[model samples]
Target: MGFRNLQTFLFFLLLMLLGLSAPLSAAEGKRLALVVGNSAYTATTPLANAAADARAFAAFLKENGFEVDSLINVDRAGFARGLSTFSKKIGPADTALFYFAGHGMQLKGENFLLGLDAELLSEFDVDAEAIALNSITGIMERKASLSLLFVDACRNNPIADRLNASVEGVTRGAALKWGWRR
Candidate 1:
């Protein structure tokens, strides 16, 4: 019985090696992407230069052989739609990436990317208006083999300059809220 099992294992290993050697190659199919820039804001004021950034990045991604789906000034509805659309557009893509450049904050120890026109009125609005970082993971869960996410949003309230003066005492806090975990 032991010898028969060993022979069976060797046969399976040989078959796997043969399969690996087979020319199962396909053109790097379609590369899907989601690029978001929150530049135009109403309550919290507009971001500095995120719109231009997103445009430039989208162009770069296309040049680098990617089918990009980018959205600028994505609000609540726009953000949701962009996510759903991007997920659906991925058709046998060799690579999938999600990128964001805008205002973002951490509440309840969770990452939230702030969209354009997001008002920091109450903390609950963080979950309401902003896109949860994990949401990206969930929507992209079974979409691709190797997934990539890039977030360039700052954690600081972008309008802290005015907010500090208007309020009373709120010095600039540390800017270490954008660290990544593996």
Candidate 2:
């Protein structure tokens, strides 16, 4: 399917899954969403649609009863702050959602989402500068009963190419894992 269609499908599927698993009573929990988009990258080619798409999706989530926290073109500090605030807001029984629209890359097996201010000078920079996808999942795993993550970022990264060229045995692979069991 097309990218836009895939996004729509994923959104509806997430809602349907939540509807199926959620408790019927209103007192059970609330829906919370953290939506972030980075378009104005200082170190790489800027994405034209990331921020707008995130804004639109955040609006949709808000309309669907989510307490949405949206961020656009956020730097590294802002990304961390947003996550910290989001984690604090999540309750034990809450349904949490995280949506990211930006540049992303996988290094050696770990997936990372880039911030607007990310500048990857070397492989070491990835761990220090980028936000690990696992960190986001970890927060959801600890804080929420039901959690969903939608990453709308590019898989092929120019920085990854440069890093791979400089480092040996840097094999690319998919490493994203999520669910109640994980």
Candidate 3:
């Protein structure tokens, strides 16, 4: 499918997963969203569409009554700060949503979302340089009544390939073992 089509599908799928047939109303409790896009990467080739897509998506969410926190071309520390602030806003009755558009890779079954300043020289750097996907989900699962995560980061990752190549017992295909599934 086309990129726009895929995004629409994912948005509808997310709403369906949350048992929502239409845009949420004010009576449904608070709606919070953290939207991030990292395009200006220093270590890897920059993405052309990520930041723009995030801005558009954030606007859409705002129109639908979501209080949005949007960040673009952010570094690791910036990402952490955004998440920390977002987590603070979430409440037990809130519906929390996270959307990320950038580079992402799976290493040893764990998914890591890359920031603009991420430099993955080895697998060891993942924890320090990248944001763990589960960390975002864990926050939402803990503080929100309903949580939705939409990751629009799928591209050829030369950094991951290099890391896999450098590590012993790590195969080229090992990164593909995990996928988004319910």
- Encode model 2's per-residue lDDT on 1-182: one tens digit a residue: 66578668866896677774554566668889999999898888789888988998898787777899999999988999999999999998888999999988877777888898888878888887899999999899889988888888865567666778887534344577744543
TM-score of predicted structure 3: 0.84
Q: Looking at candidate 1, what is the lDDT of residue 178?
A: 34
- Candidate 2: C-alpha RMSD after superposition: 2.5
Candidate 2 vs candidate 3, TM-score winner: 2
What is the lDDT, from 0 to 100, of the residue 167 in candidate 2?
A: 72
Per-residue accuracy of model 3 over 76-172 as CA lDDT, tens digit each: 9999999999999998888899999888877777678889888988878889998988888888888888887888885577777778787653232
Candidate 1's TM-score: 0.69
TM-score of each: 0.69, 0.88, 0.84
Clash count per candidate: 0, 0, 0
lDDT of 1 at 10: 37
Q: Which prediction has the highest lDDT against the true structure?
A: 2
| Model 3 vs truth, CA RMSD | 3.5
Q: Candidate 2 at 165: error in angstroms?
A: 1.1
Off by over 4 Å in 3: 14-27, 168-182
Better of 1 and 2 by lDDT: 2
Check candidate 2 and list the clashing pairs: none
